[model samples]
Target: MKYQFDKDFLWGVATASYQIEGAYDQDGRIPSIWDTFSKTPGNTYMGHNGDEACDHYNKFKEDIALLKKLGIKAYRFSISWPRIFKDGKYKLNEKGLKFYKDLVEELKKNDIKPIATLYHWDLPQILQDEGGWSNPEIIKYFVHYASVMFNALGDDVEQWITFNETSVFLYLGYLYGIHAPGIKNLDLTLKAIHNVHLAHGETVKLFKNSNYKNQIGITLNLSPNYPYSVEEKDIIAAKTNDAFWNRMFLDPILKGSYPEEILNNPFGNTLKEIIKDDDMEIISHPIDFLGINYYSRSVIKHDENETFKYKSIPQDGEKTSMGWEVYPDGLRVLLNYIKENYGNIPLYITENGAAYEDKLENGKIHDIDRINYLKRHFISAKKAIDEGVNLKGYYVWSFMDNYEWAEGYVKRFGLTYIDYETKQRILKDSAKWYSQVIKNNFIEE
Candidate 1:
């Protein structure tokens, strides 16, 4: 094993509001899209909802204790918009505010850096009533919401992410109808993407204008797309997939414009109309760092009649419990691509991990597959750093097993497995392995 990371590289784990922080109805917190969608019949798998996910809301201190025990240097978590603003307005939810305040303080007390995310796909139901991201009004609301958190916790938290995977939210929620506020409308999906970019721009502007002492960035789930074949058609399919999945968000934020390929497509003009003057400047505001969430590489082929004209094919390799391919090199490829395309901005692996169905026996979860998945990817990350990619941190996808959205509780992506029925948490073998990595700042054979 090599000590390739910087001495101060962040080691941590991440969790979202709707996925882990239950108490959905308590403390003046209003319903979010997840709350509404999960409650609706036949929406979530097996009629499951995150009504009491991991009970993190009530046990954050204990959770932080686990992070301390794991020797993690940072913790990235999302702030529930509906919890902070029951109606998406300034009427403060004292209890909701206090919850996060205390959580941050606890992390700080344990010498753990806190990375706060403003939104993680948990839009307040009130905002959803008014077209959600499809309406431009969300820009102002999101800015205000960001301001509130900045004013409340900026002193302690030095790393801030505006939106966690906005592309996923728009695509899944609006296009695929898998997540909350599910609606399968292509036109609306495109509109929602534009609105989300605008909202991100507004929030970035707000953070800059406030003179906050912190770094602001966006976390994007980027995959290295591979064409199914070397043929010209397959190559063209790969380019299209990159334009939509990777460049659609990256180009605008990093280059201040949409990818030319996407802008020249049949729906290109529609995207152009949505991009307003000065929007790019707001979106591209000089940030201190960018967060990349890499899971697997995508193998795609062209399909003219198919939506987006690129269909994902299964990879001929090992798979995670979630059925995603295990491709550590994809992480290295994406890291170098960002460095070449987006300049030398510092980057963080804000979310990386695999799901595994591990059965606990004798009071322990011997999840060897997850441990191997993490070790291989961490080596890939080390390779990136050795190759001069200014990588800053690595945070596993989650700390505790909780309600996975859409897939429900079926997919477990945590170091600590949560018995949903008993609310008992058992640390898996991966947790112990990760603890050693964090402690030594390197993996040992």
Candidate 2:
């Protein structure tokens, strides 16, 4: 097919620790912020928690078998920070480390490259009690945690992600209080954002300087911002929204400085104090690649009453089960934007998939909508690559349906259907189609 990817272009699937690894209390593993947040009344959908998730911790072999069946080249999974630090004291949890070593070994045996992520929003509850990401003191602890993982799994896991979706966790956790360690304080949110960026930089430096011969990077959930109207005010609103949503996080890492427009903006002014001498230098350490999670674009309009002065307007188009717009071309726009602004840095669509109201029929799922979503997005990615963007690979958002934070088990984003009750995973029609894509290394249109 004309939509073929390069031979080296990796195809993979991703899953987070809290979402899939259900052995929450096993092997001396302690509670993560998710465990605490999900347990609280009215925190998650129908109060559903990830107490048993997909039981991947216990069924990884089965899951990996399914992954092998899909003919993917790599598997991107995160380490449960709490699992390794069980006591929150930075003490080595050999048992916890062993689990990941085993997981990596299994992936390797199956000829799948293991892309390990250090943190996926599953901070130990004990750390949250000690101010979590908001407190600068947590940086040392995070670095120590990274050091341990590097020493333990560096040999087996060649690709490492320092953090996943920093904007989502920081915004939802600190500003909106909709996530773990939830607190609705603007000051705390700014502090958490700065600290997390600092933590990522420090960790990247550690990994790059080490003798592992592996690659390290961070994953960001990014979207292209568009104006709701041709009016200058609306255009300015889109720019402001872009500054807040995209540049605030991107500039610090790629350019070694926060975007000037955002730094002067009212919502971002408070970050100036949180930023310290040489902090930006540390936050902008060079990395091997950039992981981008693109799902939708934001159409913004000026709203003087809003805190950020830009409000998101709902678009008239097809939307996924998660209420996110299905704008595949946004992937091309976002990738090209990165290339144009950030230079030709290597990039990966680390997490991109649509959630749909999937149902099981006759022991199978017919998720044509999800298939279409993925196909269009893949085509967009191919277009960007053909246009000279250094787009490297694509990993579907999830391997199977798990505990979707806040929304809980309601939304299904998996190529494989997970029967939450029986824990039986049946390959959806989309999975069958994706298997062929991976097998052919192309989108067969």
Assess each prediction's global lDDT (C-alpha) against the native: 0.88, 0.91
lDDT of 2 by residue, 27-50 (tens): 989998999999999999999998
After superposition, candidate 1 runs with Cα above 4 Å error = 1-3
Q: Write the per-residue lDDT of candidate 1 for residues 1-445, one digit (tens) a residue.
A: 4555567888999999889988888889998888899988889889889889888999898889888988989999999998887577777898899999999999999999999998899898889999998888888888888889998998699699998987788888998898888989877887888778877877787888888877999999999989999988878899889888899999878888888887788778777787778888877777778899999998989888886777888977799988899999999999999999888799999999999888889999999999999999999999898888999999998898989888899999999989888788788999988998888788654
Question: Candidate 2 local accuracy as lDDT?
Answer: 0.91
Using lDDT as the measure, the top candidate is 2
Let me know the TM-score candidate 2 reaches against the reference structure. 0.98
Query: How do the predictions measure up, each by TM-score?
Result: 0.98, 0.98
lDDT score at residue 99, model 2, on the 0-100 scale: 90
Query: In model 1, where is the ten-residue run with the lowest total lDDT?
Result: 1-10
Q: Candidate 2 has which clashing residue pairs, if any?
A: none
Q: Which regions of candidate 2 are displaced past 4 Å?
A: none
